[model samples]
Target: MTATKLKPTLGTLHLWGLAVGLVISGEYFGWSYGWGTAGTLGFLVSTLLVAVMYTCFIFSYTELTTAIPHAGGPFAYSLRAFGPTGATVAGLATLIEFVFAPPAIAMAIGAYLNVQFPSLSPNVAAVGAYFVFMALNILGVSIAATFELVVTVLAVLELLVFMGVVAPGFSFSRFALGGWAGSDTFSPAAISGIFAAIPFAIWFFLAIEGAAMAAEEAKDPKRTIPRAYIAGILTLVVLALGVMMFAGGVGDWRALSNINDPLPQAMKTVVGDNSAWMHMLVWIGLFGLVASFHGIILGYSRQFFALARAGFLPPALAKLSRFQTPHRAIIAGGVVGIAAVLSDGAVNLQGMGLTAAMITMSVFGAIVMYIMSMLSLFKLRRSEPQLERTYRAPGYPLIPGIALALALVCLVAMVWFNPTITVIFVVLMVLGAVFSKLVRGRGAIDPQLATEV
Candidate 1:
């Protein structure tokens, strides 16, 4: 468990990149799926509600990240507040959230590529992404972070370009067509659709909290985390709403609802499929997916390294490579994601495609982790009042309370709508619990590591 520390090479900009990049793929593809279930206006309502939760959650969660400054993130906070069992839940949830997310983004990356190259297979591109990014991560934290910053900037710009290109064709009349759960007027079905759309709404900001996993490697985390998180959330809110509205307005919103590459398809409606703008969006759009996919690899590997270092998982995963990166942990997560990628079509859930199913499962883990994180924030406030908190959550009880309540509601809605994915998530949690218990009983964890947390 005694491994080299993660190098502190990340600053405010790098943290912002990681924060936004971790969830930017949501802007590109997955959130549009909400359109399928909720229609344009219904999914817009869902997005606004989830946006409030994340805005509050990030503000409150930043307090923990700054105070604890651990690679384990929620796991570390839970360990300090509620001990091993809480840590186990937070750790596994974080793991599941980070691990499952990339495959979804990777699949989107492949889909975006397939739009450009007619014969290319999405599965092949998705699998190829795992190897390329894992190697970049293994080289060094600074290099990985610098690369992340570059791609994140490009992705942000591409989104802006997309909005500009589609603005001329935007028609509120078109967007409102079947906008309320496939109905002109709101009804019981609209309510159900909004609830069912919660997971996809959450997809818009799912891994923003994963930036906390980089706390251990951040320069002056207490100062950097707040600025990065607040700015990142604001940036995403603008992009998510803009992309969804503009895309929905150009022609039939329903056409873009269920597919993986919504932006390109939406753009094709304005510019012909052969237009230069269409080609550019397809090419640059990959950066959005690549940003999230690459960033999540960094996020999940840190969780694996942190859990293993704490003796909650295999000790071998804690080892750092010559580059001071958690190479083993990175590869371990990549293996799981690649497996999910390979099983894309083989394991279908209801009528959901592999990407939609994975997005739901990832959101399931995220909501659990969000609830646990808010609980930890409350517990720590009461138990460790003296702990140095350079940045306090602005509203205290109100802000975190809102975050916790909304997270619970999202969790319930997701479970109700996606029963099969819920069962699979629960089973994974149970298996992780058993594994953690066996690992702990063997006294495999270092007492020093426990004391440090």
Candidate 2:
């Protein structure tokens, strides 16, 4: 079967919008959960460290993205460098990262809407969000990307507005009050808290790499992908710091530490629950969640399309609509996300809320992808020195080396702190491997197509 090609409608700006839009929701929720585990200061330390890791990782990852320029992202690079097994692992990890994130974002959207309409159940609203965004995605890639750009701009502006509204009430004393809630300075427990906080810190920049998944759809990808990746990371770092400082400093950080709508809750300290700003925040905050929810659905559809097109997943998922979008893949992914939402609502396993558990699982997948992608970069550099390249990772050995070390640290920390989710991730990987082997036995995958861009 011939591979289905994605429409090259996305430019650097669209890529930037998708990159930032894919992660802007992090500013609104999830990161605060770190405060619960590590306190304000410990989480801050973790965030800074994770931020550095992302900066280095993005710089290094872009080299593969630009050179390969495939919709599969890390999967394509790993396949080229490592082979079928490596591609399966990389593809499965990509699935975990992209597939698991939407349910969490959907839950956040539900939570945000619930703040306004107390009558609406969060689960119902979350399911509703999945339907709306998935349909929008099926319409077309250009339409979906344009929508991502618009909502992303609105989301960024809203965060700035939030900071401006809460600027007067920002108290350094309040921020420092719980900076070391559960641990002493440099104590073992403090150190543990910092490590335990890694996943949430990762939450701050998670899925920005999903921008690379749009490579096949990007115009002049070699030039456009790098520009988008660089600009996106810089924008996120600034927003992450600004939101963290201002929100934690507004009042008792503990009050909003684990809440879904931390921004509005923080604003409530200054504006009161009924204030116009609070109402505006509750409404506008949904845009942030929508931006990510919609963008990630876009990301995952392409991932599913890539995997299916390569025969790693069922070929039906590779089918494109008349609009030249992966409509089937979008719908398939939505089904999985909806199932996740319903399952979490029913079980509430590990005593962690649906959003938190999903985030943990997603971060686990991201760490695995990071490790594999960096290794692929190192392997390809040595073996394929003569391959055509429009861009090269700056700091070469040093930058990717730092990214690999940090990713290893994060993986170990995750296993130590989130044993259950780690186990789940491992099981998922094993199952994916089994399935891949079965598919391979049937002679489903085209070896040449699997490794080529």
Measured by lDDT, the strongest candidate is 1
Count of steric clashes across candidates, in order: 0, 0
Backbone clash total, candidate 1? 0
Q: After superposition, how far is residue 108 of candidate 2 from its true place, in Å?
A: 0.6
Off by over 4 Å in 2: 181-183
lDDT tens digits, residues 1-453, model 2? Answer: 654888899999999999999999999999999998888888899999999999999999999999899999999999999988898899999899999999999989988999889999999999999999998999998999999999999999999999999999998888877586464768887788999989899999999999999998999999999999999999999999999999999988998877888999999999999999999988888889999999999989988898888878877888898899899999988999999989865755467888899999999999999999999999999999998788898998999999999999999999999888888899999998898778766767675667566
Best by TM-score: 1
Worst 10 residues of 2 by lDDT: 443-452
lDDT of 2 at 144: 92
Candidate 2 local Cα displacement, residue 3, angstroms: 5.3
Those runs of model 1 whose alpha carbons end farther than 4 Å from true positions after fitting are 182-185
lDDT of 1 by residue, 1-453 (tens): 265488898999999999999999999999999988998899989999999999999989999999999999999999999998999999999999999999999999889888878699999999999999999999999999999999999999999999999999999999988888845556889989999999999998889999999999999999999999999999999999999999999989888888999999999999988999999999999999999999999999999999988889988898999999999999999999999999988977978989999998899999999999999999999999999999999998999999999999999998899889999999999999999889877877675686476
Residue pairs in candidate 2 whose N, alpha carbon or C atoms collide under 3 angstroms: none
